[model samples]
Target: MAGAVQWIAESVQEILQISGLTVQTFLVLCSTFFLACVVFNRSRNLPPYPAGRVPVLGHLLALGRAPQLKLTAWRRQYGDVFTVRMGMKDVVVLNDYTAVKDALVDRSELFASRSPFYYLFDAIFGFGKDIFSASWGPEFRQRKKFATTVLKNLGMRVGRGSIEDNIREEANCLRNRIAENNGQPFDVAHDVAVAVANIICSMTFGKRYDYEDETFRELTKAIATISIELGAGHITAVFPLLRFVPVVNRPIIKALEASSKVKNVMREEISRHRENPRDFLDFCLLELEQQEKVAGLTEENVMYMAQDLFLGGTDTTANTLTWSLLYMTLNPDVQNKVHEELDAVVGKSLPTLSHRSQLPYVNACLMA
Candidate 1:
């Protein structure tokens, strides 16, 4: 009877040990299978992106540094239109100008929906209805038509004589500053930027500041800084997820804070002129009143319209003028032709709008 009891206990112990081992082995196998699926499943829906990435981040790791160069290289490697998956988002890059035109202009409606990354702009400026950054919809079209009309009314049909005079004065000041540098190695980028900024300032607020003025300098610096950062490859528009990554993306947050202050300053200017307005602010206020009658334009939309004027009128002209001087200085023949034309028409006096047509060569030089 003792031997029988001992044998039964031994059999029970062996069965329990075998069951525990089997359960452990099954769990290990299940875990391995799950991990494998996770690794392989990421590539399943992806549209043939470049190889190399951690489990879910698909090529996002590569974008941690010099993303533009990497994008360019990917274009070189995988042709112009390759897919890049970043945290479940599949971004298709249209590298060629033709593709971009086709998307932005041809099938504009389908692509008109601004990408998800534009949320940052909306969050920062509260500008979901602005013409430039707004999503494509009825509101966008309304704003677009209004912007076109206002801009045309301001400058297109008749010469903006007052605006031109303001620009001319600022441009003349810029030229004198450059001349004062006496061809020394100085950064003319800032001076050129300030001239352009003052042009917008005059257009918006009916005022222009001197080059030596501290407030004006701050405004221009802020503008230049914002513009360059916005265009940089690391911009949040390019990688929206970067906004959440604190250690790697603190600069982005700081920039947003700075930009918000700048926009506030702009809004303060608008508010100051609410009672008595002039120039473009006056036009915008009038538009807002009209929009109120129509019950179509929200305040947010109106503000974005103001933002568009400030951004569009400032940065583009600045770049054009800067590049014009840069190319003219680089090409002596072009520079001499410009000087000759100036000598013939303006003759060391400040160039006026009337002399513009007469000085075609100078105009051509500028165009170049």
Candidate 2:
């Protein structure tokens, strides 16, 4: 109770300073707010939360390398549906594909909305506005529709093949970058990251950064740091007052500064696209113009949309490619099989999407 008051006191002081509220009035409002939260939590008949939860951290420390593996083990004991508390939040983990399909496909609307972490999201990007992470409603639906349409036209779907062309070109660039390494202890991770990031970059801004680009390095580093720091600083999500502590606050500030650089680049790309639209940004601007004629779509909306593509697209793809390369290097037998498949199907010719089926083993390895 005292600890809760201490945390709330920080926020209360800010509110008092901002709104000129008396201490008495602030205390009453704070009491009522917490009381309501307690009432609401007790009233809702939530899923079965697993026992053996730690004090404030909950089961967070128990999560292992593969969270799925942990959940699968738990499923045997607790059945397919159960919740685990992370911080103060109860996250219901669905163990099997059936449960996932039921929740996401069969009853999507009930589970579609995202929890708005006021400290985490609202402090950085505005709450519920980006492409994938946005609130699942009309705005998100329209944004997704717009993104897919732009992507489809740019050959994301198997037709005109502009995206594939970009991939092939980037693949060649990656190959040359590797060749430049001269089989020494060159950073495969660095090369693969730039290669993957370049593909998304080409689509988003009609240009790719050099592998040695300082800004690109900072951007990727920031994205990674944000992910790590968020997991570490998750308490801030539940209790925003944690930001008053320097250790917890520093990472958030660094992430925000890094994000600002990425956002600025996106805004610049948007500005450049205004005259002669060419890339995905061009397509988006064109779509936005049409949408504006009809209604809805702000510049801020476009900035977040582009940022989503740049940040989300690059980090995940790069991580996958890096892991794939790492695993292939680690396992000789799998690597040899992949080599044999490539030798048999691809030969001296360049590899393309067309060779996917013929090199089934290699395809499976890459996909896996």
Candidate 3:
């Protein structure tokens, strides 16, 4: 380690001597690379970004450790739509609901292009080509079309035996699991996460895993770890090169391993689907068979799409349900109202789509 450090120091000394560049000057030049990129490429009509941007690091210092909360503060100051320079990448954040709706929904096509995450997820974690991360183009369109068709075919849309049914079944399973605990106060977080994950599993993999299932637990753990690591808002996202560094890269190794396990399971299911197509996998395979095009529906695309569905479906729902439970505990009046309405609307009957209209309060509670 000392020798490596000495070598680096000597190399720096030689470069400084030859270029007649001081340490500060060299550092300044290194940072100016990102600043120059940001200044030259950005248009005048672009959204306002927060000030105090450093060269390579951009607004990272100003944003501090909790970038989300800091960005929320910046949003309040800068207005609904504002931009930020994360390294050389110019990110436009839609802070308010109106601006977000306008950008993402109203003029979606104009702003639909997905900038690749170069740092970790793209280079190392191996999801650069997935449906979620792929740039808006023919590839993304075809993959999305196929995936949507599968989802719709499996009753993800409207009417009976829909995604709601899938969720309701899992919710019942969750209730039963809780009942087994004999009314003892146990942490519902993990059970909720597993239940939510199982819904996605039933859709994608054709069946649900028991909450005690080892493989399911491992995958969820990996997904949770990935969420935490990615949520860190590390410099790696801004500076793609940093992902290669051991320290920055180590945290994601578990996520990648988990992804590998997930893809292997997907591949096995794809094989089964090829022989006798079952659920979403079968639907995807059927569509892929039609095109037979390598660009759109390759095995790689299938694996990535499956990963997207699994990750996308698991995290957000788990978070929302978990938060709802927390709020229910805090606000017992609302909780009681929800329960009372449920009892009065359909006593001794399993809730279904028809019950939804009769129980507006229940719907509102879930929505809230």
Candidate 4:
């Protein structure tokens, strides 16, 4: 296609201009030669990987429309497993589920470590002390062991009941807010984010806030910004060179600053909880104390673990709630069935954790 040629020409032109090299001139020869050396060095170091048309850039160019789908198609053409060079690094794509299972699950020790793409690991993660961000080592194992023990002792059956209760309460709040809008156009993303944040707050801090509350709103915005930015193409985990470049650094800096503010708030909250700890915070504080005394855990590591609990526990549940609400709105019959189940189970009373299991259709609707 003409577009393909245009891209190649542009890429070549940009390389020359960026290097300040004259085309077909002796003065530019050294710079071009240096560029060639860089390219060759990268190629020599690159793993045995499948490549697209472009040199160095590789399949990054052919990734059109839905890149994952395109990659799948490429796998069909190439083989079940293949590699693509994205810039200076190599990406190995395993197409077959069996291959993934054998490599990742069966041979986990070799493949267990997460790639740099884990933003939570790279930034705002206590310089690699938190279990989520900790590199493979004995310390990581110890931290994970502590976390598993704590999670098990949290009385998760009771926690599940608490979570179910919170979900119903949040659903009511969402419905009431939507009703107030009179079906007018409004952004539901904020509501979903707030609901999820509050759930996280409840579990971690044992507190909840109104969606409209200024503090809660700002907190949600910060988390949303951090989440969106990290997942965007702005940050590169695998390639350290890309991270140092000015183009990549700017957004990452902004995201990190925002994330720092969020962390400061979390730190303050942790401080407050430490001073007068209660409920889950008390539990965390007690664990921190034990770790400090027994395991010599750093303060930074403790805070990072708490931070993980706050974000991880909330965001997924909130997104799921938003999706479920959207689906219900598009299917009125399904919504009515949910209402019918709610009425039958709760008998016009606000639904509670005890009523959850009785509302099978409601549960099914939520799952769908």
Candidate 5:
């Protein structure tokens, strides 16, 4: 009996010792992590750190649902430039037009490189392969130069076979699609997205898909999914370490799946372009052949570049058109003025880029 009791006592002491060691280790690690954060923050000549920054998470919870409103409010308090701790990183916010222009236009070279840490860019774009997420360097400059040249060749000039012609054709298709709704309440988001994406498809693949084409529908759907997932505010974006957690990483997974779908379509287009060189993909392939050795222009780079163009062009344009329509519906007076301008300037003819100068109220409404 005494032996059993002594054994039990020893076991209890051993368990307590192990528990004590574990707690001590945890405290040490936590202390070290915080101390590192403090030291690193102090080392940099960073902008003013906003208040309510807790350890590790650091203002993430404070961002709330409408981060833009919160940011605007913070801008009022902290001026155009202020720092917000987003999880482990210190993000500098530029609120006003002047600061934005200065950073993006004037001192563009200094601010050209994207952060390599973002999981979205890393996973979807492969970090440096694409122009959008690439670091500012020779590879980026080469891709940018090629893209600019290709865009110039694509020509937005007001004439037959120009981008304007393509826009007019797509616009007509969109009008017809809307007419099918018979003035009833129906969502035009998908139609608008399809219209905008088709323009990009025409530029990239030298062909546009029918609105009912299964592949085209899938492509647009994937692009839309990616756009929504990006803005869906995944916790993994802030705390990348939490990517192991399934619920936290669901958005990232969805984005990856969407990206894969887009890439597969791009691959098919690229293969076709290889056989018959035409449009953006063809142009890129030709450039890749000449500059592959010097500029690190791989097939992968070409694919990603095409992906960047599609994603960048489609989402922003579609969203703008959607928002403009929403505002026009909300403010019929402004819409009437725009319609008056369009009627006066464009008349019964197909409106072209040449008519832009004549449509002042229409331009104002669009800008508004």
Candidate 6:
């Protein structure tokens, strides 16, 4: 019995020694990591990092629902520039207009590259083939030039079969849609989105869909899903390693599925455009045929380019219009002034781009 007890005690002592060594090793590793971080920050001369940054997660948990508000608060505390640790990456935040302009406008070429850290957008944009997520390089510059030229041509052309005509038609459709509500309370967000999306559809596909069209509805839903999932999966964007976790990656999966749906629709449209040769897709296809090898203008690139245009054009414009309507609703005085300006300047006629300079107040309101 004494020998048994001694054996058990020896075993327990061995286990305790092992545990002590393991803990000491872990502490050393942690200290080394933190020391490396400090050294790296000092070497880079990084801006002020916020307090309360936990290991691994960094400031993510503190960001809460409205990260902008938190960032604004941080800006006040840490000046216009600060280093924010997001997950495992250190990000430099630029606040205020002048700083942003200095970086984006003055040193535009230096900051033209998109961060490969945006894993969600990278996936949606097909691994940087799309303009929005593409790295700043020869291929991106060529694509940008092509897109700018095409858009400029489309925007400049006026009268019957032009982009202006498409916008006017969509505006009329929106007006009719509102009129159908019969002065009753109705949500205008979806209708506004549909109108904006239709304008893009017309520009891209040389076709427009009825507001209730099933395919169009599906496309918009997918886009909306992607937007929502992007927000939901922001954590994964910062900590891309989390994407491997089953439960945590639900949003990423949904985004991928939504992106697939949108891409499938775009692919179908591209196939149709191949035979008929119409609108932006045809323009892209023609370019692809000529410069496939030279400029990295592949079918994949064209499809992604269309996706970028569709996403960029639709959501932003719809959100802006919706917010303007909401602002007008909230501020009756401002709305009245805008109404007076429109009535005086536009005077029951369809307002054209030519009248923009004439209606300064309206332009100010729109700019605001």
Write down the lDDT of every candidate, Cα atoms only: 0.70, 0.76, 0.77, 0.70, 0.83, 0.83
Write candidate 2's Cα lDDT for 28-120 as tens digits: 998988856653352256667666566566677776567677777788888888888766667778878899999999999888977775465
TM-score of each: 0.72, 0.79, 0.78, 0.76, 0.81, 0.79
* Candidate 3 Cα RMSD (Å): 6.6
lDDT of 5 by residue, 208-326 (tens): 87777887788888988899987776767777778778787777888899999999999998987875556889888887777753377889999999999899999889999999899
- The residue pairs that clash in candidate 3, if any, are none
Off by over 4 Å in 2: 1-43, 48-85, 93-101, 121-125, 231-233, 292-295
State the lDDT of candidate 6 residue by residue for 129-173, as single tens digits. Answer: 888888888888888888877765666375544578678778988
Task: List model 3 lDDT by residue over 1-368, tens digit each.
Answer: 99999999999999999999999999999789866765556667888878877776667688777889988888778887888887767778887789889988999988797667555566323455677887787777877776787788787887865788777788899999999999899998889999998888888888888988987787777777767766776666777666578877676565566666766777776777765566777767776777753355666677777878887778788998899899999999999998898889888656877788999998888876
Worst 10 residues of 2 by lDDT: 35-44
State the lDDT of candidate 1 residue by residue for 260-348, as single tens digits: 66677667776776655456666667767766432377555666667666766676777887787788778998788778878988887
RMSD of candidates 1 onward, in order? 9.4, 7.5, 6.6, 9.8, 6.9, 7.6
Q: Tell me the lDDT of candidate 1.
A: 0.70
Model 4: lDDT to the true structure? 0.70
Total backbone collisions, model 3: 0
* lDDT (10s digit) by residue, model 4, range 1-368: 99999999899789888877667763467678887776555434433455454665656777766888888777777878777766555677788889899898999877876666545347767667677777766777877777665554443345552356665677688778778889788988887777777666766676778878997777766766676776676535544466567876776777787778778767777777765444455666776776643265766776777777766656666778778878888999989888887777788668766777788888777666
Q: Regarding TM-score, does 5 or 6 come out ahead?
A: 5
Clash pairs detected, candidate 1? none
How good is model 1 by TM-score?
0.72
Off by over 4 Å in 5: 1-43, 47-51, 61-82, 94-107, 157-161, 292-294
**Steric clash pairs (candidate 6):** none
